[model samples]
Target: MADQHRPGTLGHYVPYLLGRHLRAGAWPPEIGKRAILVLLGLLAVVYGLGFGHMLGNHDLSATLRANFLLGLYGTVFTSTLLVDFVPSYRPVQRLLPDHFPVSGRRSAELAFLLDLISLRRLLLGVFLAALACVPGQQRVALLGVALLLGATALSFGLRWLLTWGRGRRHPLVAAYAAVLALAGAWLTLAATKSLTGPLAAGLPWLVALLPLGLLAGQVAGLGPQFLNRNLVRPALDTAESQWLARLSPEWKAYLRKTWPALSMGLAFKVFLLVASSVMQAKHGSDSSRSIFYLVFLPVISFTYANNNLYGYLYSLTLNELQRLGLTSRLLVLYLRLAVPVLLLDCLLSAVLLVALFPASTWPLLGLLPLSAGVFLALGLWGSLSKAKPVYKNLDLMNMRNNASTLMNILTLATAATLYFMPWWWVRAGLAVSIMLTAVVPVRRLLSNHGPQRRQLHHRLQSM
Candidate 1:
């Protein structure tokens, strides 16, 4: 009887031991490292600087303070995601201690709770709290504490729900993230306006208390056995299998050329197509219906430019492309990759056109070249300016640079005006602007003999 009871007692202690092992290191050394910490610190300093303006200029307005805290919470909330979603590629059994409990749900909960109380995460919360305290805003620090704990409990429950039972459903995870983003956006917008209802008043309180229910469930042995090799293996395997099975090879290869590899932009593009359809349905004959396209068309550049233009250059090493003779041949190669993406856009646009008006959509296709020229030229100019071209450097000017961003805004406004002005000559102005923008940089890249070109080639080889 004493020996039988000894097994149960030892099993209970396994969780505490696992927690101790995880807390010892698993993180700063393994995950964040020195460089990442430095980057994170710099970002925090930038946020602190921004907050300094709020304190100085606005005298800590409630709306501004709330916005600042919510943004800070978003940054800290990333840690919960990193811990739960990022799988350890190492063999599962090796991560655990020897002689751990067989029925390990309780131990798993303990280990996960300990993992959430990570030193790095706590230090970040403390750092942000310190920054918030500089302006004598104690509420910010209190909000940070609540956010960290709430996010941890939420993530823990989600991770368990995803990993438990028969198989992993990866779409549910993406859907969850999208819903959360939309909800946050709605709340942020709503917070700026007046609140009058009991629901509005109680929402924050309800959210603050929500994590308690999840935490209680976790302690009751409802969480997944994260340390269990059998469970971890199947769940991860199923997720990978489902992902590959869902996407075709052609579509997958196309995405490889794009940023935000999930094709989130494509999703947005499809959304615009639906909007176009609705506009066509409502006021198909009205001249003002063209406003729908005018407003949303420029945004396509955001999705298209990175994939077909800026990113295309790096897809092949410079040395490899040089062998193909970089002038006309490279231009052809660029078109080959770019045309399919444009064609997809055209197909979607054509569908909207057909649904709205059963006439030729041929004129609308002209907008494709205009978009291609604008974004591609920008990409080429950005690449030419940098000695060692990085993706972000070639993408756009720093968004924080008000002057460059303002110039882009003006350009978009001017182009959209030219597009919708109804006169052929006015529309021709857009084409002229695009041609002037695109031709020179493209010619320079294709010319292929200069110190700059040689330097770029050398850099590519070294990389």
Candidate 2:
């Protein structure tokens, strides 16, 4: 009976040990070395400045201190909110079953532990530790930093646990909603000056610990239970065929046939729009909002141009079209494809502006034509340039690369114009510049590289 009980005891501890091993493997070797160097460098700098002397001379006003704390807390909250939705860092659950010959419950326990030791937590810890040495009310500043880090970690852990409990349902949607609510509450508290002195001092330490305790409880017991249940169920596949198939009827049918490329383009646009809106709503001041609008307009326009270029290039399978004796048919097909994409750009820009900033409707109405012209030029150029055309079919990776490059160039140009001129006229000029740059070279390249035909008589004589 004692020997039989031993196996059950060992099984309970298996997840904890496996989690530690997995974390050790996941962390990059360079990160540990760099973290050590950074910590040492920070210590040396603080000591050289005479930490006590610097604190004595610190001129941080009450307002400055309050703002710094607010910013720090806001950053932590945002990071916690985004952690679960981070596409690249998602846990490798599929790999777990192969590596660990254990029950799903044990496997999940290990995954939870691995997540606790994630790079995100380590970086947040480093940032908080560095803040402790900053010149301020030493005890208050240190305490504040500690509270912020603890709260952030707790929030992150809780979010992950909830996600697992929900069978990993759209965590990002919930996270975004939570973040918005928190931001609203913080603003209200700040405006009322209720977030000061006693309330601030007492709340940080206590409130921070609550989440930590909750996180520990969830991880220790509930985590394995949720994981085992979730693992037994069939995984949810997000891949939708009907939506992708609908795109085939559109003018960009040739390109849309490559479902992956279409999906990626749509996903990227949605992500950018959502992220920008969330940031603007949470952090935008009067001055910052103005700056944001100025920056955002050009950035969105550049993105529109890049997407147009991608669609155009994807539709034009130059090598394949060259073999078919149907020059007129191919040209007609290209024109049909270009028209709808150009129109879509115009529509998307109008809708996005209205959705994000309804007050900017008049400005957007004026910007639409300019945007349309720029998109047309980009699309036409992309179609004309036989350079790296998607011959067999659309390749998502290549499309991404091409789109990124085009967007980067356009964005840089917009930036330069804004720096030198910084006016509506300058923005309009930038739009015109993008059109000229794309149109002229592309036209010339296409004319030169147009499909060549060999006479049948000459081919027969050579044979």
RMSD of each: 9.9, 9.2
List model 2 lDDT by residue over 1-463, tens digit each: 5563342133545556656664563343567645654675566445434533444454957675565556556556555444544322243342253334444444544555555554444555555555455665466446545555454545455455444545345444354345356555754586456887776666556545555555455545554454433434333435545545455443344443344443444454555555566655766523234333333333433343333343334333334344653244444555566556445545654676568754733463565566556655554554343223233333321333334455445554544444345377866887788778864544443444333222211221221
Indicate the worst ten consecutive residues by lDDT in candidate 2.
454-463
- Candidate 2 achieves a global lDDT of 0.48
Residue pairs clashing, model 2: none
TM-score of each: 0.51, 0.57
* Candidate 2 Cα outliers beyond 4 Å, as residue runs: 1-57, 86-95, 98-109, 116-122, 135-188, 204-207, 226-229, 232-245, 249-286, 293-295, 298-368, 375-409, 415-430, 440-463
Question: Residue-wise lDDT of candidate 1 within 365-449, one digit each (tens)?
Answer: 5665565555454434433333232343222112122112333454456556655677767566765775587676567657864
Query: What C-alpha lDDT, on a 0 to 100 scale, does residue 100 get in candidate 1?
Result: 47
Model 1 residue-pair collision total: 0
* CA error at residue 44 for candidate 2, angstroms: 16
> Candidate 1: which pairs clash?
none
Model 2 per-residue lDDT at 1: 59
Alpha carbon RMSD to native, model 1 = 9.9
